[model samples]
Structures are given as structure tokens and as C-alpha cells.
Target: MKTAVIYNSDLHFEHKQWESELAFWKDELKSFNNRLGELVTRWTDKDVLAQLEHYQNEFILHGNVIEDLQEAMEKHEMNISEHSNKLGDTMDVPMFSTHKEIREKMETQRQIYADLKKDFFRFLSKYM
Candidate 1:
């Protein structure tokens, strides 16, 4: 038997807000992908080697876009996620779903690259 469960009065509003947030993020991701593609198209073998050198010289220049993406994720964690508190009450808001796992993983890879800069420096220093 199926039971008809009724949601809270605010559920409708929350649904609308959730839809809007999903749409906004979808657009944002599309834009980001387009920009990334443009960068890839402009990238040549020489450009790739030069960028590698630049990264070796300036660690701070690396992973800036990755950081921006992480900030976006953090913003979602702060503003969107609604989990239970100590009182065992739910926060009645919709957070990103598991489908966003890919995005999270990509960000993690970027972070790894950022961390690798330290290793790169250490390796270079040993040769000096």
C-alpha cells in the first residue's frame, strides 16, 4: 500500500528555490566548460611547455581557476546544504545531489596539481 504523505507548507517555496538554483548552476557550468574549451583550443605544444615553466617559476599562478571552483563548492556547502544538527532536525533546504560528484572530483584533482607545485620546487632545488 502506498501512503500519501503531505509536505510542509513551505515545501512549495523550497521546491521553486531549488529549481532556480539548479538552473543557475547548470548555466554556470556550461559557461565554464565553454571557456575551458576555448583555452584548450588555444593551447599548443609550445604553450603547454611554456605554461609548465611558468607554473614552475610562479606557484601562485597555478590552480587559480581551480580555487575559484572550490570556492563555489564551499559556497554551496555553506549556503545550500541542509543536514541534521545536534537536535536531529533537518534544515529543510536542498543541497547539491550526488550528480555533482564529478565536479567535486575535478576540483580534487586540481587541488592535487596545486599541491604538486611544492614537490616540483623541492625536486628543482635538489638539482641546484
Candidate 2:
């Protein structure tokens, strides 16, 4: 089966930064799964199943480390804008050109992220 993908020059440049985050999220997810299995085996509390379900649902998004990095990248845009504005205020720089390019790139990334969400949720629901 084919899969949706997200990519950008910024993403490529920050791949190493995201790698650690991805590893951490995956490790946490595996730990959660292990704990869930233990909870299932114990059959000690009635609410355990509900808690497990909640955790499973939560982990679905938590496992999306790329989303986290994308968010950080987005925040960086604000800083870039501020710095650029400072420069523009002090000197004559066509800020619009840079802003326009970044905006277009961001919009494209957002679309890809949306597509990824759709595919992930669709596939997950099928198995769930």
C-alpha cells in the first residue's frame, strides 16, 4: 500500500532534531502498550479498560512527532518575521517576498499534514 508523506527544506534541515523526538515518542508508546498489556492481564479494576482506551487514543496523536516539530517550525516563522521586521525597520528589505514564500511553503506543508491526518485516521479506524 502507498502512504502519504510530509517534507520541506526546513524539515530536511531539522531531520536530526526530529529524530530524537520521534524516538522518544515511540519509546513512550511502546511503554504504554506494555503497561496496557499488564493492565489487561491483571483484571484488577473495572476502569482499567477505559483508561487503556483513553491512553490508546491519546497515544495516536502523541506518536505524531512530526506534528510537534512542524508546530515548532511554525513558531520559528514568527521569530523570523519579528527579526525581519526589525531589519526592515532599520534598513530597506522587501519583507513581503520572504513572507510570501514562507507562507506558500507553510500552506503546502499544512496541506500535506492534513492529508497525512486523513490517511492515518482512516487506516487506524479500520484496525480499531
Candidate 3:
């Protein structure tokens, strides 16, 4: 019983961390968009313009992905809250698996974002 409580507590902490991370990434995306805007006025080459457009679209898509992940986390948290309210500190088995799935999704997003940053930096180095 004590261990279950600890496990659930850890899961809650992870969810909070993920929420914080997503928020940070969202802000970073805004900064990226602003940098792209700056690049737009300085560069008139068709290829540079095309790359900028691609990045703009990528940022938008990533923003949407972050939003969807946030919604999923919120729903998961709500489900856990509702379950605990009805049944004490014990969590449902499915909740554990669901948490695992969310963790994987977060990891995947982090990797993808890292790659995007690398590519964006390389682009800036070449063109800026």
C-alpha cells in the first residue's frame, strides 16, 4: 500500500515536469518564429526564403503537437484525480500503462525538437 502511494506520487511529479517542459518548448517556438521573422527581411534569395517558409510551417506543426500532448496529459491527470477521489490512494492498472505511453510520447517529442534545433542552427550558420 505504501509503495503504491509512492509510485503514484512519482507519476504525478513526472506529469508536472512534462507540463513544465511543454510550456518551455512552446515559448521557445515563439522565439524561433521571431528569429525567422528577422531572417525574412534580411534575406531575399529564393532558397533562403523557401527554407524560412519550411521552418515556419514546422514550428506551427510542432505547436499543435505540443497542444495535443498537453491536452492528453490534462485528461490523464483528470482521470487519475477522479479515480483517487473514488478509491483512495490506489491507482488503476491501466493508468500505469497510460502513463508509460505519455512518457514515451514526451521522449519522442524531445528528440524531434532537438533535431529541429540542430537543423535550424545549421541553416543559420550557412545563411546568416
Candidate 4:
């Protein structure tokens, strides 16, 4: 029996791709929530003088976490633009260099953001 041969079944590759994408999105949401927390503090003035309530009101008027996330990403993207494809390259990795590395770095950054958000919310909650 003669049968055509496929070079790459590539099931492993597909599985890995799926896993990475899943992780990226999960972390992405976490990061957005973190930025939103930051925005809340800014909007509310750290809950001083009942600022948290005003922030909650602002949230009702304009509920867009995506903007907050983009605002956060902008600083990171600027750093990438500043360093990427410029005069000299350093050993330090650029955040936007590659898809995999970008995601990895973004995840790390987002984890930090998330932790900060958790702590901020913990303190903020005490007031409310």
C-alpha cells in the first residue's frame, strides 16, 4: 500500500501555540484590571476626601477599561520605540522585540501591575 507522507503533523506545535495564546490572553485581562485599578486611584485621588466614590461615579459615566490598558501599554511601547532599531543595541531585551518575548515580558509586567492593583484595592477597600 502506497500512501502520501505529510512532512509535519505539527500537533505539538499547534498545542503549544494554543497554550501560549491562552496564557497571553489570561494575563492580558489581569493586566487591564490592574491598569483600571491605577486609573481609579488617579481619578479618585487615592480615596482621600471620599474620592473613591467619585471614581466609582466616573466609572458609571465612562466604563472603558480598554482605554486604561492602552494608556498603560503606551509607556511600554514608547520605551520600545525609543530603543528599537536605533543607534546601538544593548544586551537588555526589548519589550516589543518579538511575539514570544514580548508576551513573556508583558506577562511579567502585568503580574507586577496586578500585584500593585491587589495591594491598592486592599487599602482602598478599607476606606469604603
Candidate 5:
């Protein structure tokens, strides 16, 4: 037999906020992926590449979680909007193929790259 259990108002309110909570993790995943991409172009060291490969996989896993969160958010009439981010894929750099449009995007993301590089060497030391 199935019973209809009742939730208190506080618990009900928390359930209503599920979409907002998921949006937080979704945005955080995007930020971390972008930062890791910026760092990816700068480091040519094998170990760094290995670490990047590892984190890229981790964030890609998180991306799947974001997709699940998105499905949940839809039931609440809210969803995390998709940003045009091409990072954190185990695949190689997105094919630029003689396009100036990508250069424009790179210029816009310059600040993120600079920020990631500021302490990048220190961050790499741990794996070495």
C-alpha cells in the first residue's frame, strides 16, 4: 500500500527553491570549465596537459549533472540558459578553420585567461 505523506511548509518551501539551487551549480560548472579552457592553451607541459585532461573529464561529468538539473528545473518553469561554451571536452580545440569570429571570442575571454595564469605555475607544482 502507498501512503500520501505530507511535508511541512518549510520542507515544501525548500522543494520550491530547487531550481534556484540547481542554477547555482550550473553556473559554477560553466565558470570552472571556461577557466580550465583558458588554462589549456597556455600550458604545453605534459603533466599539466594530463591534469587538464583529468579536470576536463571531471567538469564534463559535472556538465551531465547540469543537464539533469536542467530537466528538474523545467518542471518548475525555470531552466539554466545554455551559454556558448566549447570548453572541457576531451576533444581538441574547436576548429577555428580560418575564421576571424573565433579571434573575437578569444579577445573577449582574455581576462579569464589572464586570471587563470596569475597563479598557474603554483597550481601546477602540486602535480609535479
Candidate 6:
């Protein structure tokens, strides 16, 4: 079996990168919401309006998910900082596990967001 080790600086860097990415996605969601509002003014067909509502609802759900993830990441960063302060730069194996879990969550969220963007663009092509 192989062992995986994560250093303090590595975790800090990862947390910073994730924070930046989540913030960017949050802003993008706001822009997408505005675009949906514009679509509302442009089209009134029942089917088109229904699709617009669907995207609007999706943006809201994603915004909530992003907020939750951001909170989780912030907590993780605080924990890491506390650990480093109390125990120096060395981290235990369990810390590596926590990092792995957060990394997986981040990857999953990124993939879902990418898929949603693609689908939204397809919908826009069809309607706008």
C-alpha cells in the first residue's frame, strides 16, 4: 500500500484556489440570472417561459450549493490554521483524509457546474 501525505502549504494553496474558483462561479451565476431576466422580457411563449423558469430555478439552487461549499471550505481552512498553529507544520493522516473529502466535493461541484453551463448554452441557442 502507498501512503499519501499533504503538507501545510499544500492545503493552504488548495484552499485559496478553491475559494477563488467558488467566488468566480458565484459571480457567473449572478450574471446568468440576469441573462434569464433578459430572456423573460424578450419572449412570452408558454414553452419558452417554462424553460426560462427552469434555468432560473437551477441558478438559484446552484447559488445555494456554492454558498454551502464555501462555508465548508472556510471551516476547513480555519481548522487547518488552528492545527498548524498548535502543532507546527506537520499534519496527521486524518487531516489528509479530510483534505481528500473536500477535494472530491470540489471536483464534483466543478463538473456539475460545467455541465449546467453547457446545457444552458444549448437552451439559449434554441430560444434566443
Best by lDDT: 3
Candidate 1, position 63, lDDT = 37
Tens-digit per-residue lDDT, 35-117, candidate 1: 44454465566755454455434443333444554455555444433432332333332333431552555556546654664
Q: Global lDDT of each model?
A: 0.45, 0.52, 0.89, 0.45, 0.48, 0.88
In model 4, which runs have C-alpha deviations exceeding 4 angstroms?
1-97
- In model 2, the Cα lDDT at residue 128 comes to 35
Model 2 residue 74 distance off true place after TM-score fit, in angstroms: 15
* Per-residue C-alpha lDDT of model 3 across residues 1-128, encoded as one tens digit per residue: 35444356577889999999999999999999999999999999999999999999999999999999999999988888887788776667888889889999999999999999999989888876
- CA displacement after TM-score superposition, residue 96 of candidate 6 (Å): 2.0
TM-scores of all models?
Answer: 0.32, 0.39, 0.92, 0.29, 0.47, 0.93
Shift of residue 48 alpha carbon in model 5, Å: 0.6
**How displaced is residue 107 in candidate 4, in Å?**
1.6
- How does candidate 6 fare on TM-score? 0.93
| Top TM-score model | 6
Model 5 lDDT at residue 63: 57
Candidate 2 ranges with C-alpha deviation above 4 Å: 1-14, 64-128
Q: Relative to the unseen true structure, what is the C-alpha lDDT of residue 84 in candidate 4, on a scale of 0 to 100?
A: 43
Q: List, residue by residue over 1-128, the lDDT tens digit for candidate 2.
A: 99533223343344345455446646756765666666567656556566557656756655564465556555655555465456532212343344345456545644654564465456345433
RMSD of 3: 2.3
Tens digits of per-residue lDDT for model 4, 18-51: 4454456456555544645665656545445355
88: Cα error in model 2, Å: 22
Ranking by lDDT, best first? 3, 6, 2, 5, 4, 1
lDDT, candidate 6, 27-78, per-residue tens: 9998898889889999989999999999998898898988888888888888
